[model samples]
Every structure is written in C-alpha cells, then in structure tokens.
Target: MNAPAGISTLDRVKIFSEITIKTFDILVIGGGIMGAGIALDAASRGLRVLLVEKQDFAAGTSSRSTKLIHGGLRYLKNFELGLVRTVARERKVLNRNAPHLVMPEPMLIPILKNASYGYWATKAGLTLYDLLGNVETPERHRMLDKTQTLAQEPLLNPEKLQGAGCFVEYRTDDGRLTMEVLKTAHTFGATCLNYCELRHFTYNEEKRITGAALQDKLTGKNYQIKATCVINATGPWSAKIMQQDQPEKLPELVHTKGVHLVVPFEKFPLKQAVYFDIPGGRMLFAIPRQGVTYFGTTDTPFTGNLEKPRVEKEDVAYLLAEVNKMFTGLDLKPGDVISSWAGVRVLLYEAGKKPSEISRKDEIFISASGLITVAGGKLTGYRKLAEQVVNKALEKYFPENRQPSGTAKIKLSGGDFENAAAVKGFLKSCQEIGQLHKYPSESLAYLVRNYGTNTKAVLKEACRLKAENLDPETRLLQAEICYTIQNEGVTSLSDFLIRRTGKLYFERGQIIAILPAVKAAFQKILTLGNGILANQESEFMEQFEAAVAFKNESKNAMVSA
Candidate 1:
C-alpha cells in the first residue's frame, strides 16, 4: 500500500476555518503524545475535537524521552500494580496498533553482585511485568548465568557479573509516533494546530468553562476557540491551566526533569536494550537509538520555572560517570555527546515529599468551572489516563448514558503495519533511480526510522524541485525542508532540524552549517503572508541556536536542577 501525503493548503484553510470560526465540542490543550492520544480517542468517539499546542507537536517532554514503550519493569519495585497493568496493556496495544513505529526490544538487565536489586528480585519483577500484559506480549523473563550473560553481552562489565536477566519491551520513535496520533486525529476530522497558546479562559455566570482564548505564537494572532468542554492534557503545564481556572486553590505539580545524551552507538556496550541502576537509584537508560547510543534520565525533583529546562554540564558528566561505573570505561565525555535534553515529568505532587517518591499515577481534576485538568502519568499509560479524563468530561454532558473511551481497540497512523523491510527496499530502489540527489546512504537509514512509510512523501517533496540541485551531505533538497514547514507544520528551524528530521540529536553541527541552504528551502516552500521572512528566519534561527545549546548542557544540571 502507498503511504500518505502531506496535508494540502486548502485542507489547512479548512482546519483554520473550523478552529477559528466554529466552536469545537472538545478543546485539547497540548499536542504531545497524551494530548494527541486524547484527540484521537475523542475524535473517534464522534466528538468534535480541537488540539492546540504552544510549540510544535512533541516539542516538549514527549519527544525528549528515552523512547521506550514498556510495561514499567522499574515500577514493579515501587509496587505500582495498576500502573504496571495499564502500561503493559498499552504497550501491547502500541505494538499491535502502531507496528510500523513500535518494535519489540530485548532488554538485558546485567545483574551485578550486591546491586540494589539482586538476581532474584530482578527475576520477580520481570515475571510480574510479563504477567501484566499476559502471554501474548512476549516471552517471559529468563535468567542467564555468568558465562552465558557474558556471551549475551560481552561488552558488559564482567568483573562483578552475577548473571543477567532478559525481558521483552518495545522501542520507538517518540516524536513520529506522537505526530502519527495527530495525523490519525486529523484523519478522523479533528483540528490540530501548533504554536497555538492558551492565553486564558472564558467563563459563564456559573463559572463553567466556555472555552479558551488562544494566541498563535507565530503570527501573534488572537483567537477565541469556544468549546463545550476544555481538557488540560498539557503534562507538566497541567497545573498552570488548573490554576488559571481556579486561581484561589493553587495546585502543585511534582515536576521532575529527565535527561538523555546521544553518542555513537559503538561507545555503549551491550546488544539489546540495557536497563540498569544509576546513582541514587533514580534510574537511567543507555539504549541504542537511531544508530546512536542515547543514555539518560536521572529523576530528581525540581522547583524551577516550568519553561525550557536546561540539561546542566554536570548532569552530562554524571550520566557519563554512571555509565562509566557500570561499563567500567567507555571513555565517554561531554564532547562525545551530540545532543541532550531535559523534560519535566508530570509526577503527582504530595506536599513535603520528593518527586521521585511521588506516585506515577495520573490525576484528573474536574473543576467547578467544568474544566478538565489531567496531569502526572508515565507515557505508557497515557491512553488509559485519557479515557479517565474523557469519561469524567462525558459524565457532565451525557450523565447516565456516558460510555468510556474505547481507544484501546483503535489503530493510529501506519498502525498494524509490517512492511519496514519492503519499504526500505522501495526507498533504496528510488535512490538508485537517481530519484534523490542529496540524501546519503548513512542518513537514509535514520530517515527511514524517523519518517516511516511517509518517507516517500518526503522523497517526493525533494524530487519536486529537480533532483540535480542537492549538495553533498544531502543538505536535504530545498523542497524537502519546505515540505516540513508547509505540511509537517514546522514553525521554526529547530522544530524542523531537531524534531521533524531529528538530525539535531545526532548531527546538529553539520545540519546547522547548512542553515543558509535550509533558509533557501524555507523561502521556496513556505508561501507565507507578505514580509514575514526576515522576522520568521530570525525567530527560527534563535530557536534553532537555543535548541542546539540546550542539548549541549550537562546531564547533572538537568538532573539536579
């Protein structure tokens, strides 16, 4: 089957008309995975859904994750039974539904002597994790002896080897999967627009929310998007929206930052994904991703501003230090990192308690003003949380006849697919035909991971501007970058180079050096309103530079901050 094409400008105009001209049934604030999940769930249920984001889709924590779709084997120690079951079920759903994006991953937990969780404890956790999703998920966890463990992962630090345990989970491209949800929502006739900020709310005499007034962060245009119900699925920003609706009862969010670093895959030891202990027992991932070894994610409580959280210089050092401890010595350094990022997880805040100790459970607050605020949950359990939030909202509207959300059975974009190898062959054939002038073989593999079946569309976009016009390093023909601006809704170069193409995480310097080329592409593809190029380019470059530097910051600052 052929892949999908980009949204047409006429279609964009229609979406604009619906969002700005017509009042929607439900307005979802946030276009990350959870918000996109909510939009897909609600739209499938026959609701007129409108999803809005302050930044590009998956621009926040959703895109900047360890990119694992698992049953939360780590949470098994915390004894979060419900979360485990829900996430396990959701993981199964993701694997079954979005097969194109979510692929099975083998995780080797290298059990060391006298570790935080020993061999038996790790085995028990894996058993529970597998049981949560039932037999259909994957093979049950198995124990490996010292010699066998070394055989499975010769790269593992063997001095203190007490054997290793293997379990089944999943790996995915988080940003693309989130965008697939957005595309799925759009396919079901939902309205989604990025750079649309929720400035404030509208209230009736009874103080029930009528909707919200949004400002397009790009055009500085104001819009009053009226809706019967408004949902705050903004993850960490959920508390802020809740406060806006009920200013007196200020609720708190247990926001904790998680950071990940990118390095060449050869630097990280082991084959399958390795889930091991970190300093402070806070947890971190050193997963192989996108042909690069990306290690991450220390969970520490934060009390800083909710905007862009920087990955500190020390946090990077700390992550390198921890991996160094486990692997003995990979000789990784700050310079080895191509990119890093910090995202505030929306954990449930309990007064006088640390964020790490706080519950991973989600919360849904139905305000007296009819605003539905959802916050604090792991990504794996987003669909279940959405059902809970949507059900609460539906109760007010339909009362006794309210049915729960049935997104569990629904498929997202390119869901239930099995043609990755065939698609790769197709792409290879196209390149052989001189269809692509700029894309390199090395980068094409990564692009396949990022673009999925829609890769043809991107290639077609490049081909549209004459195949002979590309420079070395593929500088991605001028047409391809423009497709991102017009079709993928990239509001800035950072959104394009960082999340859209996803090069920033692996090769930002090479990408940035060709900014003038990208700018030229922007000029060619984006037929914007008059005189916005200079202003837009300056703004985009500023965002692009900041995004680049933000990743260069250390992991300890990311964790400690």
Candidate 2:
C-alpha cells in the first residue's frame, strides 16, 4: 500500500525489515492508548522506539471507552481525589492540544428525590469538582431548577426530579484520539506495526530480558527485535502477556465488561447528554453523537474471550429497562437498539468489592526479569501514565542521563488548529471546498471534524476519485478509506469501519449499502487476492452483525475476529 509521504509505517515490508535489523531503546507491546502514549513520549524525547500491536491500533479497550475525557466525578465518591484531579487536568490539556478531537460539552446530572447524590451533595460535589479541575466560569457547574431542567432535557422522569447540575465534560472519538497520538509518535521516530504478535522473550547470559521474538500476522513470518526495555501496555490482556514470562505469577487484573447500546435519536429524543441514576445507585450516560443517541455501561465481572466481548440479551434488557425507567413514558424495547458495543475494563483486582466499586487508579508492576506492565487506568490519564513508564525505564536503566518528557505541549498530527474557534472556521472552509466538488455539507462537516487539517487531503482525494464510476456516497467513502489506508496503517475492512471511522457502530445501514465499494477499495489498494478479500469480508460481516445481534441471536452472532 502507498502511504502518505513521511509516514514511516506505510511501507510494511520496509518496517518489518527495519524491526529485524535495528535495535530500539524501548519496545512497547500493545498499540492501544497506553502503548501509543508511551511510544509518543519516548520517541519525542529522542529515544529509539518500536511499538507493535497484534490487532489494529485502538482495536481493544481504548476505542471502546465511554469516549469522555472526564474528571471522574464518580471517583469522588470513592474518595479517589488524586485520580480525579490528575484526569481533570488532563481533560483541559487534551482539549487544548487536540481541540478537533476533544471538545468540551455540557453534562446534565439530574438530582432526584431518591438519587444517589441529592441536591446539596450534588452542589458540593460539582463545586469541589470545578475547584479540583480548575474549570472556567463559563463552563462551570450550574444548578438548574425543575423548570430549567425540564426545558434543557424534558426526557427526565418528572415525578422525583428535584433539579439538575450542568457541568463541562469533554467528548471525543476514542479510536481517532489513539490514532492521532500514534501518528505523532511515528513522526517523532517510532516504528509501529499492527498485526504483529509477541512470541517470546530473549535474554542474555545474566538471564535478564533483552529482546522479543515477534510474528507478523500479515505475512506469517517471524523476526527478533532487540530492545533495552520492554513494556506491556495491553489493557485487558496485560496479565496474559506477563504470564508468558512468569508462568507462576498470580493474576493481577480483574476483567470487567461494560456494554453500550445505540438507538435512533427519534426513538429517544434527548436534548443533551444526561447522567442519570439507575438501580443500585449506579449511573448511566445517554449521549447524543452524530445523529443517534447511545447509552450504556453496565459493569460486571467478565470471564469471556478478550478479543470479542458479546452483548447478550440481558445486557440489552438491562440498559433499555434502566433508560426507560429514568425517562418519561417512552417504552423502549430491545428492537429499538440500532447497534451496540461491549468492552472489557482491565482493572486491578480488589478483594471483596464489586466491579463498579473497584478503583480506577492505574498501577505499574516491574518483574525481576525487567518487564514493565501498566494496568488499570482510565483513558483520560494515558499521557501521565506514559510519562511514568518512560521515566521509570530511564531512571532505572539509563542512570547516567535521562530526557525529561516533552509531550505536554506537542500537537498531535492533524490537530494544528490554534483553538476551538479556529476549528469552526476551518470546518466552514472545508464545507466550501466540498461544495465545489458537489459533496454534501453534512458529509464534509463530519470529515473536517474528524480529520482536522487532514480534510484537505480527503477533499483532494474526492476530487481525484471523481473519474471513477461511483456514486457520491461511494466516492466519499472511497476517499476516506483511501486516506486512512495511506496514512493510518489500515490493513483490514474492520479497522476502517470500526476503529478508524466508527461507521460500524454509528452508521450500520450505510455500511451495508456501501460495503461492496469498501471491499473493492481494499482489494485494489492493498492488492489483496480473492481468498484474502473473501476472508476479510467474512470477518467484517461477523462484526457488523455482532454489533446489532441481541437475545438468543447474539450468541450465534458472537465472533472472535
């Protein structure tokens, strides 16, 4: 595949050869947010770095988050103030750096008569939250009376609605955020490859860790890459990676599954995002994104396949029941769910505590063999976690000198806007460019918001693609697919639909309609044979069906792709 100029991993044949021949200061396993952040931090500070993911970047838990760069208001109840403070501060940093990816949005928390946090408690909590987060006045928490709350979001059950508390929370596309971070790392000289699996560890005479043997899943070839340090940043699969080195080590991670369901906006017409209470004092979020509304996150102990977490009949029923109970007379049913996603949270194991009660604070563990493993962190705190990992490696091994982290102010790729206001103006300009090519305004707006400064390249691709015998929608999809394949290291259809663009979860109908064009693009761009194309198409359909399959059908629809 022909990658955009300056992207290192666009040429996999070259990258594979480089991985085998060159030695790196740090080798990061897992290409999710943590590993990507670590790669960015280490590479930026002038370290030779190599990062490899068995799946596509953000294919795991990183892309499946609630997609909020929040301050962890619920953590306040657990008295995890430090965690909240750190993540709260990170929210601001991310919004400033990746303004196009992460933006501030108002979150409404209704105070009910029998709510988990009452009027006074909610007020005190939000006040403290603002102080802790250093929230600005305009976006600070505002106490809304019943009338005001109803006017803002009339979906709330009026029987016990005491009031509401509106505060700022950052919304983002988790997968895109991860990709941008990794791309920045690549620019800073990090060699990254997806579908590369770590086979085993190699050691010297002292029996200490030296390097790892990796198998390229794409080519079915094996290579040994030498590194001074190896860090395991795989979220749910962290323990599995650790045990490969020390088979006798006990489990340190507890896997908890969280499920989110998406329904059409008309079915559940929510004006704004809501954080409402459910049974057992738990809370669920109903956020409107694009054109659909998604609500989720049922946390429960999980012991299933880590690659693909199934959304069972009970999972759908639980969310629908809770959402319907919290809102007015809108009796939602299982069939109303357009699509859904389930991700496992790899948390630190705590004795005698429920899944939701476990602390979200991340912890680092170093084995005697010199393996570094990071576990149990929220998406908001990835940068800090990466800094800690890199600092630890430098201080312990390279005691002679250490490079201070410089990623605090580094702008991610495609996030070159000066501020949020500048982003809006860029969008308008992009709309004009798309209109000149006879493209729809909404499609161009979506592209600009997601691709940021890279929208120019996409628009150019759309122009070039006009020669092809394709519809407007197919041409647009092909353009976006071409760009991701060239720049984002997209190898499979699932990577483009699920992780790169989020079309599988948000726009299932369009995927079904445009899949023929998508498959054709992949086949031509990647030069895939008929067998490979068929296999990839089958795998993509399994995932597409799995997203909407509910009840007994869900079990049959479960796939390990």
Candidate 3:
C-alpha cells in the first residue's frame, strides 16, 4: 500500500516489535469510534499510542447505527436538556470540521392520533432542540399543517394526520466517518492494526496495568505490548476484555440487538427523514440515504454471543408490522427487503431494565488497577467523549505540561475540499487536458464527491496505471479498487466493498457476484497468491451467503415458536 495519499499506515510489524520490547506510552483496545477518537487525541498531544481492533474499524456497533450525526431531539421529550445540548453542540463541530461527509438535513415528525408526543409537545421539543444547537447551521424547524405536511412527505400516513414538525439535523455514512476518524488518528502517528486479537495482559508488581498480548489475524503471529496506561473502548466486548485482567474488575456486559432492513428507493423515497412512533411507544426511523431507503430498528435485549448476531424473525415481523401501520401503502413483505443486518450494542451491566430504556449517555470507569473503560454513547458524541478521556490521560501523564486542544475545529483529511466554483474551474481545466478528456464525463461529479480533494491523486493514479478495460461493479471503478488495495489498508474484499467503498452497504448483490473480479483486482495490485486470495474470497462469499440464509431462515421461522 502507498499510504493513501495523505494518510499513513502504522506498519504493524514495526509497532509490535517495539511493543514486544515493552515500549509504548498507551495501549488502546477496541479501535471503533471512541478508541479511534481517543487515539487521535493522545497521539496529537504527544503520547505514543497503539490501537488494536479485534476486527475492522467500525465493523460492529459503530456501523450498525442509524447513521445520523444529529442531536437527540427525542431526548428533549424526556427533558434531557444536558444530553441534547451536548450532542447538538457536537453536531456543529462535526459539520464544520468534516464537511465533506457530514451535512444538514430536515426531519419530519408526523403527528397522529394517540401518538406518544402530541403536536404541541413535539413543537416545544423541536424549538428546544434548535436552541440547543444554537443555529450553527442554517436549517431549522418549521411547523407544517396537514396539507402542507402531506405535501412535504407524500408517503406519510395522512389519515387523521394531526400535521408534522420539520426539524433540521445531520446525517452521514457511519462507516465512512469511522474510517475518517481512524485515518486522521493515523495521520497524527497513532499505530493502528485491524484483525488483531488481544490475548491477555501484563501487570506490574504493584498491580498497575502494564500492557497486553496481541495475535495478528493475518499471519496468526502473537506479540506482547507494554504501556504506561491502558484504555478499553471495546463496546459489546468490554466485559470480555476487562475479565481477562480481573475476573470481577467490572460487571458483565449487557447486549442489545438492533436490525436494519434496506429496501429500494421507490418503495418510500422519503423527501426528508421521518421519526415516527410504532404501536405502543417505540420509535423507528425511515431515513432516505444514497439512492435507497432503510427502516429500523428493534432494540431487543440479547444474551447471545457478541461475535455474531442473527436477526430474529420476531424483529423483522415487528418492524414491518409497525411501519405498515404508520404508512398504509407500505405492506412491505420479506421479499421486498434488499438487505438486512443485526448488531449487538453493549449496554452497561444492569439489573432489570430493558435495553431500549438504557441511556445512550457514556460512562467512564477507572479501576483500582488503573484501567480506563468507556461505554454506551451514540455516534454523534464519540469525539466529545474521547476529548474528555484524553484530557484525563494527559493530566495523569504530563502533570504540568500543556496539550493542544480544539479537536472540534481540526479539519479532517477531505474537509478542506475547495469551494464549488473552484471545483468547477478544476473540472473545466481537466476537460481541456488531452489526457483527462477521454475519461467518463458523467462520473466526474460522483468522483469529486467520493474522493473529495484526493480526486487529484486518484485521477493521477489512473493516468499512471492507464489500466484500460475498467470493470466497475457499480459507481466505483475497478481501477479504484486496485488503488484502494495499493493505497488504503484494504486487506480483504469485505473492507474494500463495505468500508473503502459503499458497494456492499448500498449494493450488496453486486459485491457477492463480483467477488472473482474484485479479488482479481486485489491480486493484480497486491500480488497476492491464489491460495491466500482464494481463502479470503471463499470466507467472504460464505459470510454473504450465510447472511442471505439468515434472512430466509427468519422468513420461515416463527415469531413465537
């Protein structure tokens, strides 16, 4: 890999070698959003950091989110002003600092008979939500009468519809945002490794936490790493990590399973995001995204293994039944679904409360043995939570030294994308160039959006390789797949399709069908032998098939049986 233009790869072999010599200021476990943010914070502030992910970044709860960067307007219904304000403020920071990915959007909260929140209450909450965000962005809330509301969202259930309140917020590609965070952390020199398993830990004689043992999933090689401080951001696996050090250091982790079902854009094609309550009091979101629509999610408590979660028949039936009620024409059956996925959210150890009622507010715990654990927050506020945790680590490490602050203002890799006119001028110049003129003009717009300021490198790389006969599965190019392997740390087809590109999440069928070509591209650039490539492809296809089988099995399985 050529380091992906501006981003840097940590060279896991080198990081592990030094760590085996018991060298590192910090050891970070679970490289999801929280850990990634903390690693960037610590690295930028001059702490030698190593972050290990048991799987790929954002492969778990982070990717399974509703994919919104908005403040929790629902929390305002419960009068949780502090949490609402906290997340709302974060929305502003992310929008400005990561503008290429995060953007403003309006949400429609349809009011109806026997709704949990009536029109009056919803309006009050939206007003407070706007106040909390403090107008960092132009979009805000507006009240819509029945006819006007129905016009705004034609698919919405208008039968006795008391009207709607439109409020502004943010949405993003969750996986992309997570990757950008990790990439930015790498830019600041945080050593990161995916598919690295934490075997155990090392402790000082005085019972201070020292380091850990890690196994590389690629080569199955094991290594030991020592650190002055250890932070666990393992999400659902937090309990597993803690019990490795002390049997009773922390309580057991509670797992909550959520499922998202993707459908065709024509099915709903909502103009704005909708937050409608299902029967009883639970709420489900119908969000329009990237030429498709998805509705979810059931927050059912689970005791199943966290390694993999299977979407149950009851969850699908419940979601469909609920949405069908709000929208009479939906009538969405199992076959209408394009794709579905289930993920487990690790809730804090609790006695009797249901997972749905569990708070999304994050908690930080420092044990007697000096291990820090962060758990239970949404995607919008991960960076803020990390800012708090890193401040603690720095005060403990440097005592009197100063550290750089203001991560909220720090621009991410592609956030500095030039203004629209500059982009248009560049495109005009590219059109005039003889070498670039032959490239597909239609794809120029999509290329600019996906690659951001890095389009220059991709186009330049395309010119350099001059690999003709490009075979792209969807919007992405086969050459771009090669570039991803040669530059981005894409080891498997899954990483490239699902994370590096949105093909899997957006068009999973093409990903399953084009495995051979994707692997061929991988082989061409990485020079991977057939045996290694074959094994990887087979497992990915099996996983994909298993996912399909899971969906079919749910359709056949009984909800109560």
TM-score for each of the candidates? 0.89, 0.96, 0.91
Look at candidate 2 and tell me the lDDT of residue 508. Answer: 81
> Which pairs clash in model 3?
none
Off by over 4 Å in 3: 1-15, 18-22, 349-352, 418-448, 467-476, 554-561
> lDDT by residue for model 3 over 1-561, one digit each (tens)?
113433322355565566576577888898778888888788878788888888877787777777789787766655668888899989878877666577777888898877677888888877878888786445778888889988888887777488998877788877778777777777777777888889888888998888888898877999878888899998888877777777676865678898887778887667778888766446788888767788888888888867667766677778878777777577887767777777788766666666666666778877777788888877898888998888777777556647766677666655563444555565555545423336666455545555555556666666655546453222236556655554455678777766666665567766656766677767876678989888877766665664545566765665646
Candidate 3: C-alpha lDDT: 0.73
Measured with C-alpha atoms, the lDDT of residue 427 in candidate 2 is 92
Root mean square deviation (Cα) for candidate 3: 3.1
Candidate 2: which stretches are off by over 4 Å?
1-10, 552-561
Model 1 regions more than 4 Å off: 1-14, 135-138, 399-406, 416-444, 471-479, 528-561
Error (Å) of candidate 2 at residue 280 is 2.0
Provide the lowest-lDDT 10-residue window in model 3.
1-10
lDDT of 2 by residue, 2-42 (tens): 12323423589888887878889899999999999999999
Model 2 pairs whose backbones collide? none
lDDT of 2: 0.88
Q: What is the lDDT of residue 449 in candidate 2?
A: 71
Task: Report lDDT (CA) for all predictions.
Answer: 0.73, 0.88, 0.73
Instruction: Determine the backbone clash count of candidate 2.
Output: 0
